[model samples]
Target: MNLKVSKEAAEWYKNEMDLKQGDYIQYYVQLYGGIPTVHPNYSLGVSIGKAENIAIKDVVEGITFYFNSDDAWFLEEFDMEVVFEKEELEFIFHKK
Candidate 1:
């Protein structure tokens, strides 16, 4: 599925979060809307529904990319609050 990410996001993951190509970065949407505590890593805060996990695939500007649907359940139902793992950077990862 095609996911949309901001240039800011890509850079944040790379520079601050040490993300690189082929990294399996995790993206989850806030099912509801609310403000999260500020952090140096997430200075812009978070955007709900900003990252969507789709069932198909493609790449384009204004889109974020996910590895694949191998773990779709975590995104769709199981791991709803994956965003809260930011402190440990546990929810996201690079393929390597």
Candidate 2:
């Protein structure tokens, strides 16, 4: 998943959002928990769709992926980018 932050949001966010893939997303499905809403820094969720890319999932309002967490557990490692656009931020999940 590629998360980009817009300069506009970054001004206030500073460091608001974190995207990670952990065994949790997979495990949660078993327990019937889709996306965990409990994140240490920010509450997180995923866009729901049969879309091939997870990024295509609903980009939650007021959330953007600006940086990755070394401490953030993910299914695998990915790239992080900060966008300067003031428009809505959308995450594009490239299938690995």
* C-alpha RMSD by candidate, in order: 12.4, 13.2
TM-score of every candidate = 0.32, 0.25
List of clashing residue pairs for candidate 2: 21-74, 21-75, 47-57, 47-58
Off by over 4 Å in 2: 1-6, 12-71, 82-86, 92-96
Per-residue lDDT tens digits for candidate 1, residues 61-94, read 3333453354343333222222223443323321
- Deviation from truth (RMSD, Å), model 2: 13.2
User: Which TM-score value belongs to model 2?
Assistant: 0.25
Determine which window of 10 residues in candidate 1 has minimal summed lDDT: 37-46
- Deviation (Å) of 91 in candidate 1: 15
Candidate-wise lDDT, in order = 0.36, 0.32
Name the weakest run of 10 consecutive residues (lDDT summed) in model 2: 21-30
